[model samples]
Target chain A: MRRADRLDRLQSALDAGGYLRLKDAARLLGVSEMTVRRDIASCDGRFAYLGGYIAGGLESAGGMGYILDRERDAHIEMKRTACDSAATLLKPGETVFIDCGTTTTHLASRIPADSQITVVCYAMNIAEIVCKKPGLRVVMLGGLYHASSASFSSPESLEMLRGIGINTAFISAGGVHESLGISCSNFHEVEIKQTAIANAVTKALVVDSSKFDQVKPAFFAKLNSFDFLCCDDGIDPARAERLAAAGVRIMLP
Target chain B: MRRADRLDRLQSALDAGGYLRLKDAARLLGVSEMTVRRDIASCDGRFAYLGGYIAGGLESAGGMGYILDRERDAHIEMKRTACDSAATLLKPGETVFIDCGTTTTHLASRIPADSQITVVCYAMNIAEIVCKKPGLRVVMLGGLYHASSASFSSPESLEMLRGIGINTAFISAGGVHESLGISCSNFHEVEIKQTAIANAVTKALVVDSSKFDQVKPAFFAKLNSFDFLCCDDGIDPARAERLAAAGVRIMLP
Candidate 1:
């Protein structure tokens, strides 16, 4: 198909549905997924490729919070791989705390719809997804809501978190630097993450390969604090070795 | 325009956008809103006019939980009036606990986007709306999620709610019989409602007139327990007098 025709088809699909999956778009356009990706990339902010889906022209993409959705879309495959690896650690009949972030959201998605487990989360997106599964019981940590991240937190909520006994807490961070330690963008999340880490029997830090060697505003914990680091196979060999040497067990999907 | 033509236009618009406002639909069809309503009402479930918006032929209506959405759509105008009255009781900087119900969800929507206040809620639908307002602080009570209602509850969460100081709690119920007392469908919500009513300085029951003199399972509190009953003028004069005589101050919007 001609480039113009493909673009027209993509635009119309977006207009009709507000969003379309890349694979679905590929099938519709009679082209490969890569070609569809290229088509979206070629456009200048006219459309957005969000978490394996192509959303209509910017301003908004239905609900799901556009900012979080956009961030979730970036490096989605790697995040999915990391989450797939992280999900294996979850055993049925166990309580797990899933943190707020694009990475942990992916992990929440990877949880089986029919699995019998209890999920504890602080983010709306995570709760929204997991609450639909009949077999999974969801516990949401409620506090003051921060819109930028679609998360809720407070001093009281943090205290509430300290009381819950979690088997495994899958924490996500904006930065995971060896020397600088781990951090995230929101300060409110700092105490909640720290509390969840402290309470959980096993603490697993779930992040994509892209977060390595980066640091953000709020420092939560040290990289060596986590029992396992779940990520994709995209980590550099030297960096992997350094992390291993630092006593961080890395789990790849 | 012909009925067939109006139906075609409505169907095509729904196909393109999934949902459209009733006013917008009327404008598009170049007819009165009542005509559009009649057209939709005449159809045998071909489309759904939900909360002033016409959703595409059902199965799903793009999240918002189809069940809750359908219930909310029923008697939406009355619910809006009740919520509008309930919102007036909210003063800046006051902490209010909004309960989990379609009526209270309407109340949450009526809250100004730029208002400065603290909102404590246990329902996802309420949190999703109030959290977006930057000036307002939202505290979510997390617990075992009931997907049927999109609300969370637990014994621990009820304990957590007891600790928070709420100026006013706008509660909703499935049934509000004069003699039978108040009740809801889910038994899990019983303790939470009782706790919030017990904690708040002012207990406000916000429900449409349709809920008056009805009874359901899981009784929580008596009708006289509420300081104010917010509803529309659609309420029967005798019923209103009976409630007022029972020491319940009815607030109409």
Candidate 2:
């Protein structure tokens, strides 16, 4: 087979399976492991120990492909849509506090560059986008930086929030229940979100419809604390009405 | 003497010296322990068991006075001068990465409002300033948040940094030895500084003159890693020449 055809097949295999080990790629491609290594070298691929042959110089393509693949799934698209719809509430020339989460990150990209606002965020990925915007001011709160989410959250974040009042806050909960309110999986995140809400004039909760009814361990604030709830149209109308009755303005997209 | 004046004297005595027990304050003010407690209550002050009177919310006038008195002997002026000098390096429309330190906090205040730039930082105080800026982009790296210095640093910061490069990096070092290179007090900070250097085209070392001879436990990088050294005029001429000879351009203000 032509080298290009072999590479194409390898790419297909990687894209399909999310990852390809050295030995597995060799067997699938009908090539020696040395040949596979040479191919990786020729392509300037990154080979991590556990995470095999990550495409090099792809800008955003080097991570474990499962994350990227999962991000592109239909279910995730709904979450992204909900996050995008929520981004519209942010006004120009205001300071916004953003917490860390995959859903909140989607909202970060939707924030207009011309809005000319300041963003205070704990998520590193969101901060990177906010930093790229010439008109936006980005503030990163310092605290224990969590490796999993690439964000900082701890008692220090709470203390820092106490020093400044925010115009608006965008937060995501792992689980949302009518009575239990917003719940998170991590205690430190709960503390950070609680403090962020305490310091904000307006609070918006951005969660996908699927996340409803699934309760996480740590209970943060009540649902009533949020001024607005932005979710996908997949949410049941009856549930939406219940939240609306509790004084949350629901926006479905 | 008037009750207020007597109370003021008692407070001063407590402030000027070590932690004063309740009995000490009472004896110094020539009042009963109950009277001292009443005075504390009148001022809305609460005492700790061992930590002394956890100072209450004093109005700006009293708070400023108290802070000034307490921090006077600290590196107040050195920190201020370092901040002033570091602020000069920032131009409008530049994304700058500031490491965590008292000196770097000084630089945070100098960022211009009208100038459009994203400030990516791990320091909580710096993020607060970015949030307040009318026109600046602030991106914060997420990692384990450390309480001592109010900053975040971890492997997560390294991974996030690998994806994007910054225009410039302003890093602080605990120790700047002529031979041993730039070092820090902690490994986490060293990792952060190393990552910041890798992600930035230009690296500027923001150090006070007093830090020239100091030595810390963790070494981040060599002295040659920095393109420019921003320090106050207090830096010794001999040492400056040595740094210059070592290919680090010095910026003294």
- Which candidate gets the maximum DockQ versus the true structure? 1
Question: What is the two-chain DockQ of model 1?
Answer: 0.14
**Number of the top-ranking candidate, with TM-score as the measure:** 1
Top-lDDT candidate index: 1
lDDT of each: 0.75, 0.64
Per-prediction DockQ comes to 0.14, 0.02
TM-score per candidate: 0.72, 0.46
True contacts recovered per prediction: 0.31, 0.01
lDDT, residue A157, model 2: 48
lDDT of 2 by residue, B1-253 (tens): 4666555444323221113456766776688877767676675532222223322111111112233334333654565566566667788888788887656755765676678877777754355345445476656665444434546665545666565568889998888988878888777787778888988988998887778879999999888999888887888788888889989998865
Off by over 4 Å in 2: A1-71, B1-253
How high is the lDDT of residue A40 in model 1?
82
Every model: iRMSD: 11.9, 24.7
Candidate 2 yields a Cα-based lDDT of 0.64
